[model samples]
Target: MRIAAATAIAIAIGLAVSLSSVVHANEEKLDYDHQEKWQSALDRAQSPIDIVTAQTVRAEDNEPLGLQLWHTQAPIEKAEDNGHAVQVNTHATEAMIRGRHFTLAQFHFHAESEHTLDAKHYPLEGHFVFKAQDGRLAVIGVMYQVGDGNPAAQAVIDDLEAKDGKLPQPSIDIASLLPNQRDYYHYLGSLTTPPLTENVEWYVLPTPVTMSEKQMTTFLSHYPHNNRKIQPLNGRAVVHHQG
Candidate 1:
């Protein structure tokens, strides 16, 4: 009788333990699913696109373009690997166009080209993000490839080494880096990043800057091929300025 009682007791304990483990596993799965759904909701619900008109880029006459560097007082938060080659931040900033002022929110880099011309891919691309006072959006895209020495590219590389991922904040002069001619390839598209909002007004510079082979290699090392596949034009108009 005692033997049978002990046998039953052992079986009961085993069942109890098994039940507890199953419950724990289910709880963990629930938590993970909740997180995934929450992230998806945030992406779908947010506004990712901004409007751009002639006034967006053209500042008031005689007024210098408002651009400032965001000097880092502390370490900045960078985006995850996500296959992106360049590490960057979205801290707030301000700049002047014509006479009005606009705020710079963030900046990031893309690799192996996203925008193609005549089916040509540039080696590198940089995006400077800005927001106008009336809530208009402006983005300046600078394309780069293998060739001559570039001062601006050198400055960014230097910053990456000196700061060692701990970026300093300072106002960047947007106008100085901009090409003398305002000619560009304009189109309406969405943010290339996830939750990929299709609201971005793209202004691809007509003239691409040059970079040395070493410079291009340096960036590629970190993000060898981080670029989203190109999206369709969706019948949107693309304006090209030859001048």
Candidate 2:
């Protein structure tokens, strides 16, 4: 009886270890610590930090964050693998964020998401990178949840399916990609990628847009893991705004 009890305990321990390995294997495919060697990545305000809702504070003046994203005639120039995330370039998409005008430079997707709400990671995340004449950048983040098929998402995904990279037909509406509700979390954070530049404004829309399983699979196939790991908050003040 004693020998049988010991053998059972050993089997259970081995099973747990095997399950743990499987979960980790399926989570990410990138070298997560690739930024550890970069000095910029070690700075005070790195991006893709988990937004702790309970800890975030409202601004002193409590002014609302006004965003003006407009439809444009500029065609989507191209969509490419970019050896990082699936990126789409736009020519004339314009944005008037908080009374300042900026042009939509390009947008990209991150598999498994870079930013997380509380501690939950979404299936996908989209970064709409806008640039001002002064070279200042303001990125609007949209999280993608698994549900109905998103037409805007499909536009890019369809191109990816046809070719490994570079869109054969460049046509997409930047406005259609965003969710109905415009509420977002405003914070001062750096770029998630290399060179990890600081002082960029990140407006992360908390509400997630829907994407079908097949669509998710198609995007993931091109780049399985492109998201950077969540960096520490480091005493930075994060604020949330209503639409």
Using all chains and alpha carbons, the TM-scores for the candidates as numbered come to: 0.58, 0.81
Alpha-carbon RMSD to native, per candidate: 19.8, 15.6
Q: How far does residue 231 in candidate 2 sit from its true spot (Å)?
A: 1.1
Candidate 2 has a TM-score of 0.81
The digit string of per-residue lDDT tens for model 2 on 1-243 reads: 122232223222222222112112222333555757545633777889999888776543435345778765457755667666787777588988756787887788888889999998998899988776655567899998889987778887767566555665577867767888987777777777655666667889988998899988888888777788888888776777666
Check candidate 2 and list the clashing pairs. Answer: none
**Candidate 1: worst 10 consecutive residues by lDDT?**
20-29
**Prediction 2 global C-alpha lDDT:** 0.71
Superposing every Cα of model 2 onto the true structure, what RMSD results? 15.6
C-alpha lDDT values of all predictions: 0.48, 0.71
> Residue 225 deviation, candidate 2, in Å?
1.6
Task: For residues 1-243, write the lDDT of model 1, one tens digit per residue.
Answer: 122232223222222222112111122212211232422212321221222233123322433333233332223343323233454444454554323455655555677666666557777776766555444454667677788865555555655665456544323333434455655655545455543443344567757777789878877776656555554443344544434
RMSD of 1: 19.8
lDDT of 1 at 224: 59
